[model samples]
Target chain A: MASRLRSTYVLPLLKQRMEMCTEAPYLKLKHAFKDRCVWEGTVEPSGLSERYVVRITYRLGYDPQVRVLNPPLVRRADRPIPHFNGDGTLCLYPVDSGEWTAADSIAYTIVPWISDWLFHYEVWMATGVWHGDEPKPT
Target chain B: MLHVVLLWPTISGMFLIMCAATIRTGMGEDAMASQPTTEVSLDLILRGICERLQISQTQHDLAEERYHAVGKWLDAEEVPRLLKTQVYAQGSFRIGTTVKPVQRNEYDLDLVCEFNLQKDTIENPVILLNLIEARLRQNALYADKLERKNRCIRIIYANEFHLDILPACPDPQTGPECVVVPDREAREWKASNPKGYAAWFLSRDTRPSVFGLARVEPLPDQETVDEKGILKRVVQLLKRWRDLRYCKDPDNAPISIVLTTLAAQHFVYQNSEAAALTAVLDGVLASIPPFGRLVVRNPMNGKEDLSERWDDAAVYSAFVSGVRNLHTQWHALVQRKGIPNITAALEALFGEQPTRVVAEEIGQRIQRARSSGVLGVQKQTGTLTVATAPAATITPVRPHTFHGK
Candidate 1:
C-alpha cells in the first residue's frame, strides 16, 4: 500500500527528501525539511532554523493524520501553534471538505500545504490571525 | 370674571396636551430601545465556551467505538462465563458532562463491569478482580492493553483514549441496587451506587432531556443530544478551569467527582448559562468553610466523601483558592463589556489556544455579519449596532403608564 500510494501519487513530491515506512494498519510517510522562518532560540542552540520531520499516517478508510513529529523547539507562547491541535496533528483543511482524495499526491498537496501552514502559523503567532485561505477544521 | 375663566381654560388645555406628548415620547423610546447596546449576548459567549469545551461528535464516536470493542471482547468465548457480565459506562461519560481533556487529547472513560453474582459467593475482592482480569487477558486484542489498577482494569487504546473498567458485584446489604467494587490497595470491597448516583444527577432540573436516563445505550444522535445546557456547560467550564489551574501538579487537582457533585448540588435552575454558572459557583464557594477541611460528600451516600483526597489543608486550600479565582474570572468575563475582556478572562481560565479558537470563531461571525450588512459600527460614537431594513410603518405603540402613575 505504501509503495502503491508513493509511486502513483506522491513519487514526484518525495523525490530524495521524503521516505516511506509502513506501520501495520497504516502507512507512514515521513519527510525531513527545514523552515527558516521558524526561529530556534538560544535554548535550542540550533540557530534560527532547524530540521523538522513531518509524518503523515494514511489508512484506507480514515483521513490521513499529519503531524510534525519534531515540531519547532520554540513554540508560540510555549503552546502548540493555532494550526495544530493538542495532539500536534497539523489540521491542513476541513477533513470533510473533500478537498483531498486518494488520487491527490500527498507529497505535492499535503506536504506543501503543511509547509504553507507552518509559514502562516509563524505569522499567526505574531498577529493572532490565520491568513491562510483554508477553512479551519471544526 | 370673563378674563379669569378664559385664562384657566387655556392653561388646563395646554397642560393636558403637554402630558399627552410626554407619554407618546416615552412609548416611542420603549419601542425603539428593544435592542440593547450590548448586542453580544451572554448566550453567544456561553455557546462559544460550550463549543470549545464540550467533547466533539468525533470524540463521542471514538468513545462509543471503544465501548463496543470492549463489550465484544468481554462477550468472547475464551472467557469462562461464571456469571452474566454486563459492561456499561459510568461517571461523566454516562452523565453527559464529559469535557475535552485539557492537557492531552485522550479521554478518560469510566466503565463499570457488573457481574450478576452475589458478594457472599465471591467472598474476597481479589478473586473478583482476578476473574475479570483473566477473562480480559484471554482476548488477544486486550491482552497487550490490559492493566490492573487498584480497583479497575485500565485498557489503554493506542494514544486515543483509555477505558477504566471497574468490576463490581451486588452488595449483600444493599440488595441488587447497590454494588461493591474491589479496592486492591485496601483489600476490601468499596460500596458504590453508580446507577443510583447517575439517576440522582439526571434528576436535577438542569439535566438535558437528551441524556434521558439511558444506562449504556449509544447516545442519541448528536443532533438530538443537546449537551449545551447550562448545567453541563458550567461543569465543562469548571473542569477546564481545574485542568488549567492544575496543569503542573495534577495529582493535587480536585477530582471531577468532587467538582461535579458540588456544582450539581449548588446548581439553581436558571435560563441563562451565565446565570446558572454564577449561581453554581457562588453555592460551591459558600459551601467551603474558612476554618476546616472542605467536605464534598456524595449526594447519594454521605459516608463516601468525594473530597476525601482533599483532607490535606494545602490541597483543600488550593482548590478553594482556584474556585474563587475561577469565580472572579467568570465575573470579569460576564460583568465586563467588550470582546477583549471576555477573551482575556477566557484565556486566563482555559489557556491561550482554546481562547484564540473561540476568539477567531467570534471574529468570523462578526466578519460574516459585516459582509452580509447585518452588523454595523457607529463611526462617531464607536458603538456596535445591528442593521435592519427600515420598517414600513413605525413600531406600533401600546399605552403604558409611567410607574403606575
Candidate 2:
C-alpha cells in the first residue's frame, strides 16, 4: 500500500475513530504487554469458557508517512485497535506463539477496518450468542 | 496504515461506501479488508494482475461445487457403511482459505475436511481417510485429488483445495506450539495481525499457517518434517508472545499454542510498553474476541524503540524469549530418531506421558504418511522415503537447511 495514500486517508480515518472516553484499552494492551511492561491479573472467567468480553482503549502513535522497509516500529493506528484488556483480569489464557505469515498480518490492517466477518464473532462469544452450534470437533 | 485511537465512525462511513462499491467490485476489496471472504485456488504462485487478484473469490464457489459433487459421486458406488459414516464424521468436507492467487495455473482444490483428532474415535480418522481416497478417485471433479499411502489417503484436487486428511488434535502435546484453531478463528486472526511476526511469515516464505482440522492428527504428514519445522518455529514465536500478553504461565495453558487471541495480545504488547502491553491487551479486550506474526527487531535497537516504555518492553521481550527458548530446545529434541514423533516430543517437551493409543495412532500416521509420501519416514537404517505419494504438491524441506537449534 502506498504510505502517502495511507497517510492522506488512513490517518485521518483513525484520528476520527477516537472518542473522548479514556477507558478504552488501546493504551492498556500496550501497557500490559510491551516488551518491557510486566503486570499480572488473573482471568476471572477464562475466555475459553463463555462469559468473557474483551475491552479496548486507544492512545495511538502517528505515522511518519515514511516508506519504511523494516522501520523500527512500523505499526499503524488504523491497524486493528489493540485492547489493553488485561486490566482487571491479568492472566490471559491461550498465549500466542509468534509464528505467522505476511498475508496473515494483513488482518492487522483489516482489523483497523473492523468489519463483521471477524469481530461479530467476538461479540457473540462475549454475549454468548451463536456459540453452541453442535459440539465441534476439538 | 493510520494510527487512530478510535476509527469506528470513519470506519463505518468508509466501510459503508466500500460495501456499496464491493457489491459492484466483485471480490469485496473492502470486504476482504473488513470481513473478507477470500477464496483460495490451486496455483501456488500469484502474479500481479487485477484479474489474478480476484481468484480467491472464485475458488470458494468452485470448491463448494466440487465437494457436493464428490459426495454424490461417492454415494453412487456401494462402499462400506463405515466409510460413509466416517467421511463426514465430525464435519463435512469444505473448501479452506485460498493461498496467494496466481494469475495462471493457480493452486487448485485447496480444500479441507474438519475432523477432531484429539477428541474423535481412534479408528475413525484412520478408516475415514482411506475410504475417502478410494471414494474420490471415482469422481471426475475430485478423482485427481486422491492418492494412496499404504492405508492413508492424500487428496490433490484438480481445482482448488489440495487437501491432506488428518485429525483435528488441538492437544498441545505435539508441541505446545501446535495449537488447535478453528477455521473461522484462523481466518479472522490472519486478517487481524498483518505485519507482526506471523504476518511476516506470510510474506517471508511459503508457510501453510496450519492444516485444516483434518490433517492435524491421526496421520501426522511425515513428509512434513519440513512443514513440521516451520510449524514448530511459528508455534514458538506465537507462543512466546502469548505468554507476554496473558502473564499466564505457558506451561499452564498449553492450549494457547493454538489460540489466536493470545497472538493478538502479544502483537500489541510487543509493540508498546507503558500502554504498550496494557494498550495491546486493551485492544485485545476491545476486539472482544479472536483467534490469532513475526518480524525480527534487534534487541538493542528494539529496546531503544521502546525506550519510553523500556520496563514493559523488557518484560514482554523476556516472556517472548522464554517461549522461543523452550520451543527451540524442544524442536531439537523431537527430531532425534526415537523422539521425533508427536507423542515422544510431547513427553520430552511437556513431560506428559502420552497414552499408548496416542503413540500408536501417531505411529500409524507416520507410516501412512511415509507410504503415501506426505511424510518421509526415516528408517532405522537412516534412509528416509516419503509415503504421502506424489499425488499432492507437498514439498520436502531439506534437513541441511534446518538450523535445528
Scored by TM-score, the top model is: 1
Candidate 2 lDDT over residue span B144-230, tens digit each: 556654323556654445444432323334233232222222221001111132433333234433221123332222223223223
**Model 1 C-alpha lDDT per residue in residues A19-124, reported as the tens digit of each score:** 1111011223233333101111111100111234555665533445666656442455655456565565666655544455444434324443444444344335
Write the residue-wise lDDT of candidate 2 on A51-99 in tens digits. 2122222212221111101111111233421221212211111112111
TM-score of chain B of each: 0.77, 0.29
Tens-digit lDDT track of model 1 for B149-206 = 8888888886678899888887747633577788647377777778878877777764
- Best-matching candidate per lDDT: 1
Each prediction's DockQ against the real complex: 0.01, 0.01
Instruction: After the best TM-score superposition of candidate 1, give how far the Cα of residue B394 lies from its true spot, in angstroms.
Output: 12
In the order shown, the chain A TM-scores of the predictions are 0.54, 0.19
Give the alpha-carbon lDDT of every model.
Answer: 0.56, 0.27
What DockQ score does model 2 reach against the true complex?
0.01
**How many residue pairs of model 2 clash at the backbone?**
149
